[model samples]
Target: MVGTAARALIVSERRITGLSQVVIADLVAELGPVWQARRDAELCDRPRRRAVGAGAKYKLVFVDRLLATLVHLRHGITHDVLACWFGVDRSTITRAIGEIRPLLAGRGCRIAPGLRLRTLADVIAHLGATGQTGIIDATEIRVRRPAAHRRGRNRFVSGKSRTNAMKALVVTDDRGRLLFCGEVRAGSVADITQARDAGLVDLLADTVHLEILADAGYQGLAAQTYGQVVTPPRKRRGKNLEQVQWLMAHHEQARFEHSSRRIPVEHGIAHLKNWRALARHHGHRHHLPDTIRAVAGLLSDQQATHKRKLAALPTGQSR
Candidate 1:
């Protein structure tokens, strides 16, 4: 339902989709074939009564569908607003998002063609192989509070943020490039508990070269992983600090150094949150995991492209 002028305007300005023109072009080229193949497979599973071109044509083309989905995820624009922009019904926007989101999620965080990191295990393997230090952290996203009578409603309340929220563990490389985003959990869940539930300890135990830097929230993980997990140094609980000022000063310095190394994860989390879909959720909680993974994939592609550009720049020139 988009008019010719409106479509042209959107095409001319890539910022409407929150992606560079190059990135959007790349996504369209990559997604077109995959989407067509999926539709073909669906037709094969359930034969259409009419021929492929015999039915009513879609108003929004494949590119428009992909653009709408990206805009929604990047800006957190509602289906109603999208409907007005595209001159279509809200259901049209909803259907397009439902169709496109899963494909992006399936692509995962793409470092290169045929080398997407889809799970935590893939992330760990890549880190070990590349000998790069990883930073791990958890972030909370606000969600709608459940009804009073809903079962386990209290589980959604986060003791740290004092709100109804969900928590997700994000893993990034030393330079703050995202590598993986784990599944969402109840906000009330502790950081260490979430890591344990995700089998992070087991994964770290298996790797010899992979090291992860984390904050004080993951205090006990270092011992569990035989020191593969690094956390800030803790002060002696029952010691007379004034009597051992020199030792206390050393511990403070150690903590400072650990924090400096772990700061990149904070930047990574901020980058992820820049996608409004992850900043806050207005949709069903069940849909959040897919959105998170999909956004991470898109962001990773953007970051990878940016890194390539930086590397291409001449020495002594500003990026």
Candidate 2:
């Protein structure tokens, strides 16, 4: 007889890990060999007969250990609960996460898009080769408020979100494939500032054309420098939007069209937040960049796999 927690973790992966069985199996195939190698090296480094309680041996198999850590990440489940489910001590779950988190993050970096825009030409060529038109936006993740005595703590308060949050600039292709997630910044930082700091505005007008789709929050940002910056028309302080449009020959309908086009990036951001860690972060804030990168890569791989499976189907059938 299997326990409820065990059944949830091992049998219904999507319930506990937020990933389908097929994807989990694929991940094991990809990460199993490296994990085994590391485990073997650690075992070799240990004494033949260790001191009592210096280290307790792991009870679960390699696959279960990996699955346990992933479930913790996806569901933000407590270690004590995980220990009960896996029939291991709480410390074992902690050790597993300590070892596996970095591996998963490293795997994420491999699939993430590179953003080395050394020159304007590089920006143009990179975007052209990877994707032509893309959306740029900022997302803020909520975090526990730091104590008042903590230095530089005030920087994390975001007026926009009205909470203590960390912000990141996210860029994605028209298809919603994540291109890059900028380094985490204090939520007080503006979206345009994040983009400029991340070199999204490094392109020169005289060079190749780069179309960047952005929301109204990023108005008047390198409008002349970058090939083009598409943003919605902003209303003047004293005038209504309709009046401003009528007086300035601006069409409000165009703004609606622009927003319609930017929806995919919004969906991408929502997809990244599905892992729950981003929903409410309780860990070290510094680890967020790695976590975001890892999730993006996993999503990209999952999407690719879905496409491949769809392609294999017969012409008359639908997935």
lDDT of 1 by residue, 1-319 (tens): 7777876677568567656777778888899999999887887787578866677788888888988899899889999999999888999999999999988888888787567899999999999999999999999999999978999999989999999999998999888888998678999999999999989999888889578999989999999999999899887543675757877788899999988888888898898899999999999998888999999898888888888888899998997
lDDT of 2 by residue, 63-179 (tens): 777787777777788789888877878888878777777777665422222332323244345676665786888899998889879998889999897899998777777878666
Clashing pairs counted in every model: 0, 0
Q: Would you estimate the TM-scores of all the predictions?
A: 0.94, 0.80
| Per-model C-alpha RMSD | 1.8, 4.9
Instruction: Pull out the clashing pairs in model 1.
Output: none
Q: TM-score of model 2 relative to the true fold? A: 0.80
Question: Distance (Å) between predicted and true CA of 33, model 1?
Answer: 1.5
Candidate number of the best lDDT:
1
> How many pairs in model 1 have backbone atoms within 3 A of each other, for residues 3 or more apart or on separate chains, i.e. clashes?
0
Off by over 4 Å in 1: 11-14, 237-243
